[model samples]
Target: MLPTKMTEALNNQFNNELQAAHAYKAMATYFSDKGYQGFANFYLVQSKEEDFHAMKFYHFLVTMGEKPVIQGLLEPKSVFENALDVVKQSLEQEKEVTRDIYSLVTLAEELKEHSTKAFLDWFIKEQIEEEDAFRTIIVKLSGIQEGGEYFLKMDEDFSQRTME
Candidate 1:
Protein backbone atom coordinates (compact mmCIF):
# COMPACT_ATOMS: atom_id res chain seq x y z
CA MET A 1 0.00 0.00 0.00
CA LEU A 2 1.18 3.52 -0.69
CA PRO A 3 1.57 6.16 2.00
CA THR A 4 -0.93 8.99 1.92
CA LYS A 5 1.61 11.70 1.09
CA MET A 6 3.31 9.62 -1.55
CA THR A 7 0.02 8.66 -3.13
CA GLU A 8 -1.11 12.26 -3.23
CA ALA A 9 2.13 13.34 -4.88
CA LEU A 10 1.85 10.58 -7.46
CA ASN A 11 -1.66 11.62 -8.30
CA ASN A 12 -0.49 15.16 -8.78
CA GLN A 13 2.30 13.98 -11.06
CA PHE A 14 -0.19 12.03 -13.12
CA ASN A 15 -2.26 15.15 -13.59
CA ASN A 16 0.79 17.19 -14.51
CA GLU A 17 1.71 14.63 -17.15
CA LEU A 18 -1.72 14.99 -18.70
CA GLN A 19 -1.28 18.74 -18.70
CA ALA A 20 2.05 18.34 -20.43
CA ALA A 21 0.41 16.28 -23.15
CA HIS A 22 -2.21 18.98 -23.64
CA ALA A 23 0.46 21.64 -23.91
CA TYR A 24 2.32 19.64 -26.52
CA LYS A 25 -0.86 19.20 -28.51
CA ALA A 26 -1.24 22.96 -28.54
CA MET A 27 2.31 23.30 -29.78
CA ALA A 28 1.59 20.77 -32.51
CA THR A 29 -1.43 22.79 -33.61
CA TYR A 30 0.65 25.93 -33.77
CA PHE A 31 3.24 24.20 -35.91
CA SER A 32 0.58 22.81 -38.24
CA ASP A 33 -0.96 26.26 -38.64
CA LYS A 34 2.43 27.74 -39.48
CA GLY A 35 2.96 25.24 -42.33
CA TYR A 36 5.73 23.36 -40.58
CA GLN A 37 4.44 19.84 -41.11
CA GLY A 38 7.61 18.25 -39.83
CA PHE A 39 7.52 20.31 -36.68
CA ALA A 40 3.86 19.51 -36.30
CA ASN A 41 4.53 15.78 -36.57
CA PHE A 42 7.30 16.05 -33.99
CA TYR A 43 5.06 17.77 -31.50
CA LEU A 44 2.19 15.42 -32.17
CA VAL A 45 4.49 12.50 -31.41
CA GLN A 46 5.64 14.34 -28.27
CA SER A 47 2.05 14.79 -27.19
CA LYS A 48 1.46 11.07 -27.53
CA GLU A 49 4.54 10.31 -25.48
CA GLU A 50 3.34 12.62 -22.74
CA ASP A 51 0.05 10.80 -22.72
CA PHE A 52 1.89 7.53 -22.35
CA HIS A 53 3.85 8.98 -19.44
CA ALA A 54 0.67 10.04 -17.73
CA MET A 55 -0.78 6.58 -18.14
CA LYS A 56 2.35 5.07 -16.67
CA PHE A 57 1.81 7.14 -13.54
CA TYR A 58 -1.84 6.21 -13.46
CA HIS A 59 -1.06 2.52 -13.71
CA PHE A 60 1.60 2.80 -11.03
CA LEU A 61 -0.86 4.41 -8.66
CA VAL A 62 -3.44 1.72 -9.34
CA THR A 63 -0.93 -1.06 -8.90
CA MET A 64 0.00 0.45 -5.56
CA GLY A 65 -3.67 0.16 -4.55
CA GLU A 66 -4.24 3.88 -4.73
CA LYS A 67 -6.97 5.60 -6.69
CA PRO A 68 -5.59 7.93 -9.38
CA VAL A 69 -7.27 11.28 -9.42
CA ILE A 70 -7.06 13.37 -12.56
CA GLN A 71 -7.57 17.11 -12.45
CA GLY A 72 -8.44 19.71 -15.04
CA LEU A 73 -5.66 20.94 -17.30
CA LEU A 74 -4.90 24.56 -18.04
CA GLU A 75 -5.06 25.61 -21.67
CA PRO A 76 -1.67 25.65 -23.36
CA LYS A 77 -0.32 28.74 -25.09
CA SER A 78 -1.16 28.87 -28.78
CA VAL A 79 0.81 31.90 -29.86
CA PHE A 80 4.52 31.76 -30.62
CA GLU A 81 6.78 34.36 -32.27
CA ASN A 82 8.51 31.63 -34.26
CA ALA A 83 9.72 28.05 -34.20
CA LEU A 84 12.63 28.99 -31.95
CA ASP A 85 10.20 30.58 -29.52
CA VAL A 86 8.23 27.33 -29.39
CA VAL A 87 11.34 25.27 -28.84
CA LYS A 88 12.50 27.61 -26.06
CA GLN A 89 9.13 27.34 -24.37
CA SER A 90 9.31 23.56 -24.65
CA LEU A 91 12.77 23.53 -23.05
CA GLU A 92 11.48 25.67 -20.19
CA GLN A 93 8.59 23.30 -19.70
CA GLU A 94 10.91 20.31 -19.59
CA LYS A 95 13.02 22.07 -16.95
CA GLU A 96 9.98 22.70 -14.85
CA VAL A 97 9.01 19.02 -15.12
CA THR A 98 12.50 17.98 -14.08
CA ARG A 99 12.24 20.16 -11.00
CA ASP A 100 8.93 18.60 -10.10
CA ILE A 101 10.31 15.10 -10.53
CA TYR A 102 13.26 15.99 -8.31
CA SER A 103 10.90 17.24 -5.65
CA LEU A 104 9.05 13.94 -5.76
CA VAL A 105 12.29 12.04 -5.45
CA THR A 106 13.30 14.12 -2.46
CA LEU A 107 9.97 13.60 -0.84
CA ALA A 108 10.08 9.85 -1.38
CA GLU A 109 13.58 9.67 0.06
CA GLU A 110 12.60 11.68 3.10
CA LEU A 111 9.63 9.42 3.67
CA LYS A 112 11.71 6.27 3.22
CA GLU A 113 9.61 5.16 0.27
CA HIS A 114 12.27 3.19 -1.48
CA SER A 115 9.97 1.71 -4.08
CA THR A 116 8.66 5.10 -5.01
CA LYS A 117 12.18 6.43 -5.27
CA ALA A 118 13.14 3.54 -7.52
CA PHE A 119 10.15 4.21 -9.76
CA LEU A 120 10.98 7.90 -9.95
CA ASP A 121 14.55 7.13 -10.98
CA TRP A 122 13.24 6.38 -14.46
CA PHE A 123 11.58 9.79 -14.59
CA ILE A 124 14.80 11.45 -13.49
CA LYS A 125 16.62 9.88 -16.41
CA GLU A 126 13.73 10.67 -18.73
CA GLN A 127 13.76 14.33 -17.74
CA ILE A 128 17.45 14.53 -18.54
CA GLU A 129 16.80 13.12 -22.00
CA GLU A 130 13.80 15.39 -22.50
CA GLU A 131 15.76 18.51 -21.63
CA ASP A 132 18.69 17.46 -23.78
CA ALA A 133 16.42 16.79 -26.76
CA PHE A 134 14.79 20.21 -26.56
CA ARG A 135 18.14 21.92 -25.99
CA THR A 136 19.51 20.26 -29.12
CA ILE A 137 16.50 21.47 -31.08
CA ILE A 138 16.99 24.98 -29.71
CA VAL A 139 20.64 24.95 -30.78
CA LYS A 140 19.70 23.83 -34.27
CA LEU A 141 16.87 26.38 -34.55
CA SER A 142 19.01 29.19 -33.10
CA GLY A 143 21.69 28.65 -35.72
CA ILE A 144 19.28 29.15 -38.58
CA GLN A 145 17.15 32.26 -39.01
CA GLU A 146 13.49 31.25 -39.49
CA GLY A 147 12.33 30.52 -43.04
CA GLY A 148 15.40 29.61 -45.09
CA GLU A 149 16.92 26.62 -46.84
CA TYR A 150 18.56 25.45 -43.62
CA PHE A 151 15.31 25.83 -41.70
CA LEU A 152 13.48 23.82 -44.33
CA LYS A 153 16.12 21.18 -44.17
CA MET A 154 15.77 21.00 -40.41
CA ASP A 155 12.03 20.70 -40.83
CA GLU A 156 12.57 17.83 -43.24
CA ASP A 157 14.85 16.15 -40.75
CA PHE A 158 12.28 16.55 -37.97
CA SER A 159 9.58 15.14 -40.21
CA GLN A 160 11.48 11.91 -40.35
CA ARG A 161 11.15 11.36 -36.59
CA THR A 162 9.08 8.33 -35.65
CA MET A 163 7.99 6.95 -32.32
CA GLU A 164 9.97 3.89 -31.41
Candidate 2:
Protein backbone atom coordinates (compact mmCIF):
# COMPACT_ATOMS: atom_id res chain seq x y z
CA MET A 1 0.00 0.00 0.00
CA LEU A 2 1.04 3.56 -0.55
CA PRO A 3 1.15 6.35 1.96
CA THR A 4 -1.36 9.11 1.31
CA LYS A 5 1.29 11.61 0.27
CA MET A 6 3.01 9.08 -1.97
CA THR A 7 -0.26 8.15 -3.54
CA GLU A 8 -1.01 11.77 -4.25
CA ALA A 9 2.39 12.26 -5.77
CA LEU A 10 1.95 9.22 -7.98
CA ASN A 11 -1.37 10.56 -9.22
CA ASN A 12 0.21 13.90 -9.98
CA GLN A 13 2.92 12.17 -11.99
CA PHE A 14 0.31 10.19 -13.81
CA ASN A 15 -1.53 13.33 -14.78
CA ASN A 16 1.66 15.00 -15.86
CA GLU A 17 2.40 12.08 -18.16
CA LEU A 18 -0.99 12.49 -19.75
CA GLN A 19 -0.36 16.18 -20.17
CA ALA A 20 2.89 15.34 -21.88
CA ALA A 21 0.99 13.15 -24.27
CA HIS A 22 -1.48 15.89 -25.01
CA ALA A 23 1.34 18.32 -25.55
CA TYR A 24 3.01 15.93 -27.98
CA LYS A 25 -0.19 15.47 -29.91
CA ALA A 26 -0.50 19.20 -30.29
CA MET A 27 3.05 19.32 -31.56
CA ALA A 28 2.25 16.55 -34.01
CA THR A 29 -0.63 18.55 -35.39
CA TYR A 30 1.57 21.59 -35.72
CA PHE A 31 4.18 19.60 -37.61
CA SER A 32 1.62 18.07 -39.89
CA ASP A 33 0.13 21.46 -40.69
CA LYS A 34 3.60 22.73 -41.51
CA GLY A 35 4.17 19.91 -44.03
CA TYR A 36 6.48 17.84 -41.87
CA GLN A 37 4.53 14.64 -41.78
CA GLY A 38 7.44 12.52 -40.70
CA PHE A 39 8.12 14.76 -37.73
CA ALA A 40 4.42 14.85 -36.95
CA ASN A 41 4.17 11.07 -37.01
CA PHE A 42 7.21 10.92 -34.76
CA TYR A 43 5.45 13.08 -32.19
CA LEU A 44 2.25 11.08 -32.62
CA VAL A 45 4.19 8.00 -31.65
CA GLN A 46 5.67 9.94 -28.76
CA SER A 47 2.18 10.86 -27.62
CA LYS A 48 1.25 7.19 -27.60
CA GLU A 49 4.32 6.37 -25.58
CA GLU A 50 3.49 9.10 -23.09
CA ASP A 51 0.01 7.68 -22.74
CA PHE A 52 1.52 4.29 -22.03
CA HIS A 53 3.74 5.81 -19.38
CA ALA A 54 0.73 7.47 -17.78
CA MET A 55 -1.11 4.17 -17.80
CA LYS A 56 1.80 2.48 -16.11
CA PHE A 57 1.53 4.94 -13.24
CA TYR A 58 -2.23 4.55 -13.22
CA HIS A 59 -1.91 0.78 -12.88
CA PHE A 60 0.67 1.12 -10.15
CA LEU A 61 -1.60 3.45 -8.23
CA VAL A 62 -4.49 1.04 -8.67
CA THR A 63 -2.39 -1.81 -7.34
CA MET A 64 -1.58 0.38 -4.36
CA GLY A 65 -5.30 0.86 -3.74
CA GLU A 66 -5.44 4.44 -4.87
CA LYS A 67 -7.78 6.00 -7.42
CA PRO A 68 -6.01 7.93 -10.15
CA VAL A 69 -7.13 11.47 -10.79
CA ILE A 70 -6.25 13.05 -14.09
CA GLN A 71 -6.04 16.82 -14.17
CA GLY A 72 -6.33 19.49 -16.85
CA LEU A 73 -3.51 19.79 -19.35
CA LEU A 74 -2.05 23.05 -20.62
CA GLU A 75 -2.10 23.71 -24.34
CA PRO A 76 1.13 22.94 -26.14
CA LYS A 77 2.97 25.53 -28.20
CA SER A 78 2.23 25.22 -31.90
CA VAL A 79 4.04 28.17 -33.47
CA PHE A 80 7.51 26.79 -33.97
CA GLU A 81 9.64 28.89 -36.34
CA ASN A 82 10.86 25.80 -38.15
CA ALA A 83 11.55 22.10 -37.82
CA LEU A 84 14.87 22.63 -36.07
CA ASP A 85 13.24 25.02 -33.65
CA VAL A 86 10.61 22.43 -32.88
CA VAL A 87 13.29 19.85 -32.19
CA LYS A 88 15.12 22.33 -29.96
CA GLN A 89 11.97 22.91 -27.97
CA SER A 90 11.42 19.17 -27.68
CA LEU A 91 14.93 18.63 -26.38
CA GLU A 92 14.46 21.36 -23.83
CA GLN A 93 11.17 19.89 -22.72
CA GLU A 94 12.75 16.47 -22.34
CA LYS A 95 15.51 17.96 -20.16
CA GLU A 96 12.86 19.59 -18.01
CA VAL A 97 11.09 16.23 -17.69
CA THR A 98 14.34 14.62 -16.59
CA ARG A 99 14.68 17.22 -13.87
CA ASP A 100 11.10 16.67 -12.77
CA ILE A 101 11.69 12.93 -12.51
CA TYR A 102 14.83 13.48 -10.48
CA SER A 103 12.93 15.76 -8.15
CA LEU A 104 10.28 13.09 -7.67
CA VAL A 105 12.94 10.55 -6.84
CA THR A 106 14.44 12.92 -4.30
CA LEU A 107 11.05 13.55 -2.77
CA ALA A 108 10.40 9.84 -2.45
CA GLU A 109 13.75 9.36 -0.80
CA GLU A 110 13.07 12.16 1.66
CA LEU A 111 9.69 10.68 2.49
CA LYS A 112 11.22 7.24 3.05
CA GLU A 113 8.95 5.89 0.33
CA HIS A 114 11.14 3.08 -0.94
CA SER A 115 8.48 1.67 -3.20
CA THR A 116 7.98 5.02 -4.86
CA LYS A 117 11.69 5.28 -5.38
CA ALA A 118 11.75 1.84 -6.94
CA PHE A 119 8.83 2.67 -9.15
CA LEU A 120 10.44 5.91 -10.25
CA ASP A 121 13.59 4.08 -11.27
CA TRP A 122 12.00 3.07 -14.54
CA PHE A 123 11.12 6.68 -15.32
CA ILE A 124 14.60 7.82 -14.40
CA LYS A 125 16.08 5.38 -16.88
CA GLU A 126 13.49 6.34 -19.46
CA GLN A 127 14.30 10.02 -19.06
CA ILE A 128 17.93 9.23 -19.80
CA GLU A 129 16.98 7.66 -23.10
CA GLU A 130 14.52 10.43 -23.82
CA GLU A 131 17.11 13.12 -23.29
CA ASP A 132 19.69 11.19 -25.28
CA ALA A 133 17.34 10.77 -28.20
CA PHE A 134 16.50 14.44 -28.34
CA ARG A 135 20.10 15.38 -27.86
CA THR A 136 20.94 13.39 -30.97
CA ILE A 137 18.27 15.24 -32.91
CA ILE A 138 19.53 18.56 -31.64
CA VAL A 139 23.02 17.64 -32.75
CA LYS A 140 21.79 16.73 -36.17
CA LEU A 141 19.71 19.89 -36.47
CA SER A 142 22.62 22.03 -35.35
CA GLY A 143 24.48 21.10 -38.51
CA ILE A 144 21.72 22.16 -40.88
CA GLN A 145 21.76 25.89 -41.62
CA GLU A 146 18.40 25.95 -43.34
CA GLY A 147 15.23 23.88 -43.67
CA GLY A 148 15.36 22.25 -47.08
CA GLU A 149 16.42 18.87 -48.34
CA TYR A 150 18.69 18.63 -45.28
CA PHE A 151 15.70 19.10 -43.00
CA LEU A 152 13.77 16.49 -44.94
CA LYS A 153 16.64 14.06 -44.56
CA MET A 154 16.80 14.86 -40.87
CA ASP A 155 13.10 14.19 -40.56
CA GLU A 156 13.56 10.87 -42.30
CA ASP A 157 16.35 9.98 -39.92
CA PHE A 158 14.39 11.05 -36.86
CA SER A 159 11.39 9.05 -38.07
CA GLN A 160 13.54 5.96 -38.07
CA ARG A 161 13.96 6.24 -34.30
CA THR A 162 11.54 3.77 -32.76
CA MET A 163 10.13 4.46 -29.29
CA GLU A 164 11.26 1.14 -27.81
Candidate 3:
Protein backbone atom coordinates (compact mmCIF):
# COMPACT_ATOMS: atom_id res chain seq x y z
CA MET A 1 0.00 0.00 0.00
CA LEU A 2 1.08 3.58 -0.65
CA PRO A 3 1.59 6.09 2.11
CA THR A 4 -1.05 8.79 2.31
CA LYS A 5 1.43 11.60 1.66
CA MET A 6 2.91 9.79 -1.30
CA THR A 7 -0.55 8.97 -2.58
CA GLU A 8 -1.58 12.61 -2.39
CA ALA A 9 1.56 13.75 -4.19
CA LEU A 10 1.06 11.13 -6.89
CA ASN A 11 -2.52 12.32 -7.36
CA ASN A 12 -1.29 15.87 -7.81
CA GLN A 13 1.33 14.69 -10.30
CA PHE A 14 -1.32 12.85 -12.24
CA ASN A 15 -3.36 16.05 -12.47
CA ASN A 16 -0.29 18.00 -13.52
CA GLU A 17 0.30 15.56 -16.34
CA LEU A 18 -3.29 16.07 -17.48
CA GLN A 19 -2.78 19.80 -17.36
CA ALA A 20 0.32 19.39 -19.49
CA ALA A 21 -1.70 17.46 -22.03
CA HIS A 22 -4.28 20.22 -22.13
CA ALA A 23 -1.57 22.85 -22.56
CA TYR A 24 -0.01 20.92 -25.42
CA LYS A 25 -3.39 20.58 -27.11
CA ALA A 26 -3.85 24.32 -26.82
CA MET A 27 -0.42 24.83 -28.35
CA ALA A 28 -1.34 22.47 -31.15
CA THR A 29 -4.46 24.48 -31.84
CA TYR A 30 -2.45 27.67 -31.94
CA PHE A 31 -0.07 26.20 -34.50
CA SER A 32 -2.90 24.79 -36.58
CA ASP A 33 -4.60 28.18 -36.66
CA LYS A 34 -1.33 29.74 -37.81
CA GLY A 35 -1.00 27.21 -40.66
CA TYR A 36 2.05 25.53 -39.19
CA GLN A 37 0.83 22.00 -39.70
CA GLY A 38 4.12 20.40 -38.78
CA PHE A 39 4.34 22.25 -35.48
CA ALA A 40 0.73 21.41 -34.84
CA ASN A 41 1.38 17.75 -35.47
CA PHE A 42 4.29 17.77 -33.06
CA TYR A 43 2.25 19.35 -30.31
CA LEU A 44 -0.58 16.93 -30.93
CA VAL A 45 1.78 14.04 -30.41
CA GLN A 46 3.11 15.72 -27.27
CA SER A 47 -0.39 16.09 -25.92
CA LYS A 48 -1.05 12.42 -26.49
CA GLU A 49 2.19 11.51 -24.77
CA GLU A 50 1.22 13.60 -21.76
CA ASP A 51 -2.09 11.80 -21.59
CA PHE A 52 -0.22 8.51 -21.65
CA HIS A 53 1.98 9.68 -18.81
CA ALA A 54 -1.06 10.53 -16.72
CA MET A 55 -2.52 7.12 -17.35
CA LYS A 56 0.71 5.47 -16.32
CA PHE A 57 0.46 7.16 -12.97
CA TYR A 58 -3.16 6.17 -12.65
CA HIS A 59 -2.29 2.54 -13.31
CA PHE A 60 0.60 2.68 -10.86
CA LEU A 61 -1.64 4.01 -8.14
CA VAL A 62 -4.14 1.25 -8.78
CA THR A 63 -1.48 -1.45 -8.81
CA MET A 64 -0.25 -0.18 -5.47
CA GLY A 65 -3.69 -0.59 -3.95
CA GLU A 66 -4.45 3.09 -3.89
CA LYS A 67 -7.35 5.02 -5.32
CA PRO A 68 -6.43 7.73 -7.85
CA VAL A 69 -8.26 11.03 -7.64
CA ILE A 70 -9.29 12.93 -10.72
CA GLN A 71 -9.23 16.68 -10.69
CA GLY A 72 -10.39 19.49 -12.99
CA LEU A 73 -7.89 21.06 -15.31
CA LEU A 74 -7.51 24.79 -15.85
CA GLU A 75 -7.81 26.30 -19.30
CA PRO A 76 -4.53 26.35 -21.16
CA LYS A 77 -3.30 29.42 -23.00
CA SER A 78 -4.50 29.42 -26.59
CA VAL A 79 -2.54 32.32 -28.04
CA PHE A 80 1.12 32.92 -28.68
CA GLU A 81 3.02 35.78 -30.24
CA ASN A 82 4.98 33.45 -32.51
CA ALA A 83 6.27 29.93 -32.96
CA LEU A 84 9.35 30.75 -30.93
CA ASP A 85 7.12 32.01 -28.16
CA VAL A 86 5.29 28.70 -28.21
CA VAL A 87 8.53 26.77 -27.93
CA LYS A 88 9.65 29.03 -25.10
CA GLN A 89 6.43 28.44 -23.25
CA SER A 90 6.80 24.70 -23.77
CA LEU A 91 10.31 24.80 -22.31
CA GLU A 92 9.02 26.70 -19.31
CA GLN A 93 6.31 24.14 -18.76
CA GLU A 94 8.80 21.29 -18.99
CA LYS A 95 11.00 22.97 -16.38
CA GLU A 96 8.05 23.31 -14.05
CA VAL A 97 7.21 19.63 -14.53
CA THR A 98 10.79 18.67 -13.80
CA ARG A 99 10.58 20.46 -10.49
CA ASP A 100 7.32 18.76 -9.64
CA ILE A 101 8.75 15.36 -10.49
CA TYR A 102 11.80 16.07 -8.35
CA SER A 103 9.57 16.97 -5.45
CA LEU A 104 7.75 13.67 -5.77
CA VAL A 105 11.03 11.81 -5.76
CA THR A 106 12.09 13.67 -2.67
CA LEU A 107 8.89 12.85 -0.88
CA ALA A 108 9.10 9.20 -1.80
CA GLU A 109 12.66 9.08 -0.51
CA GLU A 110 11.68 10.70 2.74
CA LEU A 111 9.09 8.01 3.28
CA LYS A 112 11.43 5.22 2.11
CA GLU A 113 8.96 4.07 -0.49
CA HIS A 114 11.24 1.88 -2.56
CA SER A 115 8.68 0.91 -5.14
CA THR A 116 7.53 4.47 -5.63
CA LYS A 117 11.11 5.67 -5.95
CA ALA A 118 11.84 3.05 -8.59
CA PHE A 119 8.75 4.00 -10.51
CA LEU A 120 9.63 7.68 -10.39
CA ASP A 121 13.05 6.93 -11.84
CA TRP A 122 11.49 6.61 -15.24
CA PHE A 123 9.81 9.98 -14.93
CA ILE A 124 13.04 11.62 -13.81
CA LYS A 125 14.74 10.43 -16.97
CA GLU A 126 11.72 11.41 -19.03
CA GLN A 127 11.78 14.90 -17.61
CA ILE A 128 15.41 15.27 -18.64
CA GLU A 129 14.61 14.20 -22.17
CA GLU A 130 11.59 16.47 -22.29
CA GLU A 131 13.57 19.50 -21.19
CA ASP A 132 16.39 18.72 -23.59
CA ALA A 133 14.03 18.29 -26.52
CA PHE A 134 12.36 21.63 -25.90
CA ARG A 135 15.67 23.38 -25.24
CA THR A 136 17.12 22.03 -28.49
CA ILE A 137 14.13 23.36 -30.40
CA ILE A 138 14.37 26.70 -28.63
CA VAL A 139 18.01 27.01 -29.68
CA LYS A 140 17.25 26.17 -33.28
CA LEU A 141 14.31 28.55 -33.34
CA SER A 142 16.33 31.32 -31.77
CA GLY A 143 18.95 31.02 -34.53
CA ILE A 144 16.32 31.35 -37.27
CA GLN A 145 14.70 34.73 -37.79
CA GLU A 146 10.94 34.98 -38.09
CA GLY A 147 9.36 33.95 -41.42
CA GLY A 148 12.63 32.58 -42.75
CA GLU A 149 13.05 29.52 -44.98
CA TYR A 150 14.95 27.76 -42.20
CA PHE A 151 12.13 28.36 -39.82
CA LEU A 152 9.68 26.83 -42.25
CA LYS A 153 12.03 23.91 -42.80
CA MET A 154 12.21 23.39 -39.05
CA ASP A 155 8.45 23.37 -38.93
CA GLU A 156 8.43 20.69 -41.59
CA ASP A 157 10.91 18.69 -39.55
CA PHE A 158 8.82 18.99 -36.42
CA SER A 159 5.76 17.73 -38.26
CA GLN A 160 7.61 14.53 -39.08
CA ARG A 161 7.83 13.60 -35.42
CA THR A 162 5.92 10.39 -34.62
CA MET A 163 5.16 8.75 -31.30
CA GLU A 164 7.89 6.31 -30.40
For all predicted structures, in order, the TM-scores are 0.98, 0.91, 0.97
Residue range 1-164, candidate 3, lDDT tens digits: 89999999999999999999999999999989988899999999999999999999999999999999999999999989998899999999999999999999999999999999999999999999999999999899889886689988988898899988
For all candidates in order, the CA lDDT equals 0.92, 0.83, 0.94
The 10-residue segment of model 2 with minimum total lDDT is: 154-163
Sort all candidates by lDDT, best to worst: 3, 1, 2
Task: List ranges where model 1 is wrong by over 4 Å.
Answer: none
Model 1: per-residue Cα lDDT at residue 82: 91
Where does model 3 exceed 4 Å of error?
A: none
Quantify how close model 2 is to the true structure by its C-alpha RMSD in Å: 1.6
* Top-lDDT candidate index: 3
What lDDT does candidate 2 reach at residue 162? 65
Point out where model 2 deviates above 4 Å.
159-163
